[model samples]
Target: MAGEITETGELYSPYVGLVYMFNLIVGTGALTMPKAFATAGWLVSLFLLVFLGFMSFVTTTFVVEAMAAANAQLRWKGMESRQEEDDDNSSTASDSDSLLQDNYERAEKRPILSVQRRGSPNLFEITNRVEMGQMASMFFNKVGVNLFYFCIIVYLYGDLAIYAAAVPFSLMQVSCATGNDSCGVEADTKYNDTDLCWGPLRRVDAYRIYLAVFTLLLGPFTFFDVQKTKYLQILTSLMRWIAFAIMIVLALVRIGRGHGEGHPPLASLSGVRNLFGVCVYSFMCQHSLPSLITPVSSKRHLTRLVFLDYVLILAFYGLLSFTAIFSFRGDSLLDMYTLNFASCDIVGVAAVRFFLGLFPVFTISTNFPIIAVTLRNNWKTLFHREGGTYPWVVDRVVFPTITLLPPVLVAFCTHDLESLVGITGAYAGTGIQYVIPAFLVYHCRKDSQLAFGPGAVNKHRSPFHHTFWVGFVLLWAFSCFFFVTANIVLSETRL
Candidate 1:
């Protein structure tokens, strides 16, 4: 009974949904967070992480409410279609009388604003999937929908770029550790691109080689339908948990044995810009909420489940980041946290080092194709027209080529994962995590009230239903843009 299949998708218990949300929110961004935290200073990072987590939670609730509203809109439209069908069908006088009597009885049983149940879920029950793009179309005007697509497209591009860079970066770091060559290197020594990887081959060149290999191997999937199999999902999730657990335990042991090397400052403004962005990126799941929320069998405690999930994610991120900062110096930290354990001096076992070094390669390699295909599909959707079909080349080649090239080029140009993450999260992430939800909830509220009237209630209405909260979210998004841009300007000026 707990697991039911609908036309849209299979349903799971709310607890499973909670786990999915947690997994979605704590991906690559969490790994990049400790360095940002260390650079920004513990005190500042702590305050910002907590505040961003709360803000993310609020926006998540907004998205949930918007989901309910989207469902209601779909249901309302379905009713209208059915009504038209009924009106078209001729009936005998007695049948017409029976229909009128039934309508009157239902009206007497419910309020004027209430919709008649036709053996379907309640109007506001989220039993169907409403993709963010669909919701945007329902709630926003043309300009707004275009802006929504642009923001999300940019975010996905950044995601692909990050994945493209990270896999190669991890491979380079691991491949560089051969025989006895890098064993003598100090733990705090930051290798430059010019550094030797194998004999005369430069690290940067090695990175490019791996990048080419990664592209050649996984790039073709963008042109075709590829999905993460259940087994693959399970494998990646297991690796993720094992990798994080190993890092945390090693950090704790390092601190316990009196070999701790980190001493972060109380506060620092220089790192705040990146930290803010990283925090925002780490907490991002709003864009994918529909896919996650619609499958839940019971949404009675959905908000509560979401709140609990956020709390767990926050605590896990804190544990990972805090342990990392105290266990390693800020300068010694790698953009990929797992790479920090790629040395024998840290993990002491060659196999463990190799596993930690290549973990991102394994996990990210699987995800890159999925994201690329998604981006390609989005491009197709963006330009798609009513009653029009694309040419074979445009359908098959053009979209995939455009989707796969830019991010790969970006990855080719630079592999500065920190800057990639910072800029991506600060701008595109803000639009997704903050701006989109605020507007969606606000617009959806207005539309729902207009369609269903004031007395109609949305069972999944956000706790922060006041107009002030919506305004606050939009104001905060704008403030983030201003803050990040100013910081970039100041940093450039100083340089």
Candidate 2:
């Protein structure tokens, strides 16, 4: 059961792999981008979004290279183990004396087995299933591996908080009776906790109720194993495409009809902080590359496929954000863009309005449980001792309780999805996407050089293989953190 849960059988072509990556990167973050674009101004948003996308693609290549190197090392170790077993079986009394000498020589040469390979193509075989955790163990020191897990855990926590808030927020938007039902109505009427919902309960109270209901329904799944089947992915991808297409076309039509009310600025330094976070969040697929890339039938053009995927995603985000900023005033765009179409004036048909409004509900609901289960597993891995079994209470109760609580409590406190995404993407997201990959590739290259020698070539190395690229990424990550921190300090001082 554990093996089945962990292993995703290789069942996809390079094209399918591209699509899967595209879907993975362009999730909830993309939905919130238009508002960020409007706030940062279109020009700054465009430059930053493109730049961030390029950086994300670079790190993606880095991860892929590390994965290949990991596979090579694992293969080398397996062959060495088999040879040792054979030697043990075939040893004779006469050979015992020579065996000691051979052992000394082997002890000297064993480290080389990981880096130096004979002239066999099989030595560089890419069939191993080296997950990020396993690769961290292989390449990173104990501290680095723990840091990697910690970064991932924090990012996943942010994901859960965003998901928890988004679903309930969407529900409140569509089901609550108080909001205007017509599209392009008054744009400034922000609903508050005091706003009535369903006769007696206020909107904030309704939101909490939804959060509790959400926890009750999906929280239990965290205690047990869960896998997202191919069919589930296909269904969600289908819904995503349909919803996005409707939005883009609807916004374009509205603009063509001269109904566009938005005049976004060309640049806004004040909004750059959140915009940075949103773009970082949108281009996040680095942490999931192992599951995404490993199943490809052929990876000769894996880099090209990933590049194309990012290109499409960048184009999609640009189109979505551009249309949104043009079609609606900056203040009017919802955190979840699908809500924009959930009115009679924009979408006309009641069915379409409800479908678009509830899109987050459908998509995020499926994801919340999966993410919760993943967070639970990460906790187990973090404290797991070798040859040790966890107490049933710890396994089934404590981890799930911790996993389900913090994010839900966050959702309970506020449904500020934009700030949640911005902070998550800016900090933890930056670490996972930028800083960690830079270090991973840097160290992986050093390790490969030590194992395979300086002249050894890695087939999967990034096009930006120069050591300068690593420094550039780390430098950029530092600049971003510095800028965000300064912005926060400055904003609070002004307040």
Candidate 3:
């Protein structure tokens, strides 16, 4: 908790918190989902999506409970520290009464309406933001904490790689013409990197040029702090909603006209690996739960709010993917689904095509710097020592360079957004979403029971509070890693 920045702004109602959670979970992942759905087949995708969403919700509750436990621990320690100070000072009776009144007033400010009588269950309320990293430090051993940082670092790298590739890929699709006559590329024509963009420029060459421009433009912010402005968030969210609405509407209209070209198989194991990864990524809000959940003015029905949000997200995903798979042939689907509409033959409107293509460019460019700075800070934290300072060059230059270089190099190697996303979601996302939550809840519960009496109850405990659920989550995580690794091996062998 010491290293993390807690949310200090005004708290909102739970409904507003619900909307924030929804916005957080449904970003880049949703755009790539339609292709995964088509590849894995509609029926399988639907079932898997529903099941994974449920699993994610269960883990989210686990995280919320851990937060409450963390807050309780901090509160209990503060009280103990005050009591120790009072004892050392040998305070008079009046002073003791005054201190007691002060503590009660502070407790009253929180949801708990009672005084902190030593071992009281009511004193443990989630009135503060305890981030996942802080929780890891509290509960995990030294090695476990290091592993947590490593997993997060890997996930952020994958995130940067995706953002790096997406902007230029979108730009290439929008600017390139098949024959240099200003006619847009056809939807069905399979263009490889070797295909001409301009007369002498290959599509890959054009993408690299844009990649360099993108890096030069946005990469410098890694060295400086870049926070998302309130207006920037509003603008990006507005564009996101408009673009998604357009795509869904267009797909429905196309399908209604009986021009639907997708006839997906009932099931396909070959696509299961990526679909698993994609669903995990899509349902991911566990890592940032503290930031999103702590600002809720009331959390009495927090679990129900989370369930409702998941239901809506699942419905939205179904609508988007089903409509998309039906609107376009499976073979013609693009890795970035928006580019599928950038083709003039599919969209028929130049402005709409360009807007759809440029949407990620606008949103991701804003996000890349924030994420890079965060990764750099995390690097700083990992190597940080007590009562010591980093040198200017290492603190300012070294960490940022290491953070930016790997992802850019990955982008330079290949613009395979699907593979990058799949690997990221499957491995690092698994650790963050599933394994970490399970262990956090497990250890936090034990710590809570020990700190408070055995009879103390955590009001925010998950519905799946039994130890069975925690074991089940860990088992599931291991199985997922195994399955994904095997699939990757088989695919490579065939290749």
User: Mind sharing the TM-score for model 3?
Assistant: 0.93
TM-score each candidate: 0.95, 0.92, 0.93
The Cα error of candidate 1 at residue 171, in Å, is 0.6
lDDT of 2 by residue, 1-495 (tens): 112222457457788878888899989998999989999999999999999999999999988888878877777678779997877775653377787887787679776554345323455556667788888888889999899999999999999999999998988878773253434223434667787877787888888888888888888888788899879999999999999999999999999999888999999999999999999999998888887787777788888989999899999999999999999988888788888776666777777888888899999999988999989999999999999999989888999999999999899998988889999999999999998888888888888777667767777878999999999999999999999989989999999
> What residue pairs clash in candidate 2, if any at all?
115-451, 115-452
- Where model 3 places Cα greater than 4 Å from the true spot, the runs are 1-7, 91-121, 178-181
**CA RMSD, predictions in order:** 2.6, 3.8, 4.7
lDDT of 3 by residue, 136-253 (tens): 9999999999999999999999999999999998888888853453556666668889988888999999999999999999999999998988799888888899999999998998
Off by over 4 Å in 1: 91-121, 179-185
| Weakest 10 consecutive residues of candidate 2 by summed lDDT | 1-10
Q: Evaluate all candidate structures by whole-model CA lDDT and list the values in order.
A: 0.89, 0.85, 0.87
Candidate 2 residue spans exceeding 4 A from truth: 1-8, 92-122, 177-189
Judging by lDDT against the true structure, name the best candidate.
Answer: 1
